[model samples]
Target: MNDYAQYEKDCEAIRTTNQQLLTEFSAWLKTAGLAAGTIKNHCSNIAFYVNEFLLYEEAIEAKDGFTEVDAFLGYWFIKKAMWSSQASIKSNAASLKKFYTFLYEKGLIDKQALADLKEDIKDGMPLWLATLARYEDPDEEDVW
Candidate 1:
């Protein structure tokens, strides 16, 4: 296969394992009493992180993903996703935080790292929003 096709195949292989964790994450959300729509959104958002961003990688642990989370929220999601805004960014970060919590509770991630990730989200929101704004620029500044 060609490069893109090969990459697609690799991503699919990774998702096969990641999907099991997602199922567990969904169950946890239900037990926590989240609405069905909210659960679906969380699962979908995390699936994007796992299936897209974590592609062609060996390790699939939460500890290895914090930097990926930063890139996803700070850049890729803003440029590629239709829902690009402060609220959407916050929502995505929240989804990832919940997912990481699930991983932590499952003993898949370091507790301290998870706590740090939460703080990073709280601290990084403004910067993420500014980066998104820069990405959305329509060249208005050059019109003068």
Candidate 2:
């Protein structure tokens, strides 16, 4: 099989489970009384994080540890996404926090892993933005 064919196979393997978790995360947000727009944005953010980054790194579920989160926020998103900026970095970080909290409540990731992930965000955020600065136009609106 060609490379694209293998990639497609890998994607297909995770699709159902990925959709189920995202759908449940969406419902959980609704139940939390989040606004329609907020729920949409969070779910969209998580989907992109999972499907594009984590899954690309071979993560099949929300049970992964801090290394995955750090890599996504610190590197791949900026490298892969055209719209990346300080605001987007911050926004996706918030979304991932809430989404992972939900997964924690659902007993996907353990309490220790969640705590470490948050710590990873705190410690590594500066470096992530500095890396982003290399690619960002300082004069751009919302570049921060």
Candidate 3:
């Protein structure tokens, strides 16, 4: 197969794996006593992150997605997701933290990786929110 075909096959495999992980994550959320609606929201958020954003340009596995959170929240999500807003960004951040924590608990990621992901979310939230503000501002000179 050619490179593009190989990329497609790889992405399909990752997506298949992601579905099982999401199912387990959903159950974990339930065990934590989260409301059904909240669990649904979190699972949806993670599905978008792992399935769409992670697969958009490359077949990035969900376990490897901690490193992409910065770009996803700070730029790509704002530009790409039609539902992008302050509330949604905050919601997604929370979901990501929870998902990474789950991965860490399952030994899919190291402690340092989880720590770094949390730190990035904490440090980048203000800027990410500001970027959304600018992107949504009609009169902003440069929205890019």
Q: Against the true structure, whose lDDT is highest?
A: 3
| lDDT score of residue 15 within candidate 2 | 68
| Lowest lDDT block of 10, candidate 3 | 135-144
Candidate 1 lDDT over 1-144, as tens digits, reads 887777667666667778898999999999999999999999998887887666634334434686577767887788778877888898899999999999889887887979888888888788888887777788645311
Per-residue lDDT of model 2, residues 34-107, tens digit only: 99999999998888887777667464555563458778878888878999899989989889889888888998
Each prediction's whole-model lDDT (CA): 0.79, 0.81, 0.96
Between which residue pairs do clashes occur in model 1?
A: none
* Model 1: CA > 4 A from native: 1-12, 56-63, 140-144
Residues 1-144, candidate 3: write the lDDT tens digits.
Answer: 998999999999998999999999999999999999999999999999999999999999999999999899999999999999999999999999999999999999999999999999999999999989999989997865
Question: Residue 50: error of model 3 in Å?
Answer: 0.3
Q: Compute the lDDT for candidate 2.
A: 0.81
lDDT of 3 at 106: 97
> Candidate 2 regions off by >4 Å?
1-10, 57-59, 137-144
| Order by lDDT, highest first | 3, 2, 1
Global Cα RMSD, each model: 3.8, 4.0, 0.7
